[model samples]
Target: MESAIKWTSNETVLGFGKDAIAFLDTKLFSKKSPCDKKMYEILIIEPFYGGSHKVLIDMLYKALEDEYSDSKICMVTMTAKKWHWRARTSALYLSQVIPKQHAFRVMFSSSVLNLGDLIALRNDLADVKKIVYFHENQLVYPVREKKDRDFQYGYNEIVTSMVADTVVFNSEFNRETFLKSIKAFFKVQPDFRPKGLEGEIRQKTRVLYFPVMYDVGSHSKDYESTLHIVWPHRWEHDKAPEDFMKVLRKLSEAHCDFTVSMVGEQFTDVSKAFKEAETSLFPHIRHWGFLPSRREYLDLLSRAHVAVSTAKHEFFGVAMMEAAFNKCLPLCPKRLVYPEIYPNECLYNDSEDLFTRLAAFSRNVSAIKEVVADVKLDFSKYSAVNLLPHYVSLFK
Candidate 1:
């Protein structure tokens, strides 16, 4: 049987033959009425939809849907594993699945989609404005080993940026690093190099912080007398769970009166450090692994007095922001996105510095509480309500 699917310059026609047309009517490609056309529909493509990435897009969707009565949103997402494969193939799947009748004014996608490839193939989507949001770019992403490094993912991001009408990054650091890395990538290219593509992409780029929904209740007022520390980050190599375990070990050696909640999602390839910590620091652990529910997670966060981070790479610190919103005193490394989000007092220079601060916090809980109480940190900027206008303006 001949395939009924046929690609045209303006539209993709499914079941195109005369016999197939009787089964599949023109309703597939027909335009909407004037009243229906008044509505602005957006198609969001997030290939890696898990963890922080999922949380971010979900929040954005909710904000837009609730706030703008005239706007409509549709999502096409994939699981967050084998990211390279996802980036390579998601667009092909999306093009086939998304209905032709749905007239999307804008197509919002993450860096996970090879936008250049997608846009080039889907002539029907040519008229639709494309906006690419970078939660994390492969250009500056860290690899555990040199041999595991593949430049194709980074190249895909570069192509994605070039094809996008506008590009948004979650942090200034992320934007700057991506821009700089692309320049270096160009320098290393063998021949027939493209000039000014980075600059062109940069000109269209904008920095917008991830919108955090403030759900932390007033329960934070009741801080436990005992020092309760929380490490709410994924148990992965990039998060550097070993450093966190080392801090716990130092606290244990000092015989500090503290309890730790080692909470975060665990993947198949478990970090050996976590196993070591499980055995060694079992006594101090109050809660371990991913919390059962959001309520339970927030309750744990509220009860805790300090939130710590020992990440080796972070484009944006959403976990840290959530902890801070819950009134947990942040004690993070001075590198990555921490310096931009946290005050100098909250940052530690080295592992020894982190150990000293953790020990001090445990010994003098009152001091840290005072710091948390006195610090008038404004998290309003990260609020979805505040960021919605900026997002809406992008469609203009």
Candidate 2:
């Protein structure tokens, strides 16, 4: 069976909306498995196969398949939509869909799926060497209010990590934050509190940077005088598009010579700032909305002088790394994974600091250009060439 399942953005499965649920023919994995057949060496199971999650799986499958041509590998993935639903019910659905009798040496999945529940439901996979990768832990996931936070999501992560033989995180910050917040996250529960969960989870945890492949594009020299700023992130509340727009608004009010390209994956729940920006920052808008083609997105990044990230919640910053690799100066917040990935020169302490730096850069584009050219932001550690071998070791 083909590893990837194609589905249009507007297409709906059953009565569920386009983003709610996806259906796949079970016959693909349901065929009888004989005892004499060679056991599958590896299994890649991704419940929320979208965004960075999908990218990682696709990268792993391609690299592993190429490396182990003689061995048999199986992959089962669902579309990346309705993330909450995927987290809640994907284990049950995938448990039924996955082959029962097939023996596998290693199994890999993201934190989105409840590995414990899946193994409990499908005993065939209980003996497999389970590896759970955490892209973002629910413990540190930002919400407006403590009451608004769902206890089950964070609890699921704890349970998933507990059951897995190895728990991999994209960054040290992610691993530490998730581990530290385990006890506090469960404080919402009145009684019967869990203890020593963090220590147990810590034993199995390791940090692995998300592998990124960069295609160096021909930098556009047409708009050298005007500083081109790109904000490439999801159109969601967590990304803090509102704060980004506010900074852009201040720059606009100051009459800074800058063109803005606001591009990233858009979903049903879009931040109101995007709509407001269309009217407020209309004249300065250069390229807006998600670009379907990777080449075009890279080209846009190549053209831009500055790639700004106002993300309130980010675990591993793939987009910012890509932007930096494309020769764009990355201006990110001091907190989160930014400090780990980017140099102090590229980080801002507060919104006022962000505005101050951008405004100064806008007045003199050469300074920003020189800084991008001079600053040696080494992305070698995060490149696929350096990291693929590490990932390949996990399967063995």
> Can you give the TM-score per candidate against the true fold?
0.84, 0.89
Clashing pairs in 2: none
- Candidate 1: the clashing residue pairs are none
Query: Which digits, one per residue and each the tens of the lDDT, describe model 1 over residues 294-333?
Result: 6677778878888999988888888788899888998889
RMSD in Å for all candidates: 10.0, 7.2
Q: After superposition, how far is residue 177 of candidate 2 from its true place, in Å?
A: 0.3
Off by over 4 Å in 1: 1-40, 67-71, 144-148, 217-224, 267-269
Q: Each candidate: what lDDT?
A: 0.74, 0.80
lDDT of 2 by residue, 363-387 (tens): 8887876787777677889987688
347: Cα error in model 1, Å: 0.8
In terms of TM-score, which candidate is strongest?
2
Worst-scoring 10-residue span by lDDT in model 2 = 19-28
Count of backbone clashes, every candidate in sequence: 0, 0
**For candidate 2, what is the total of clashing residue pairs?**
0
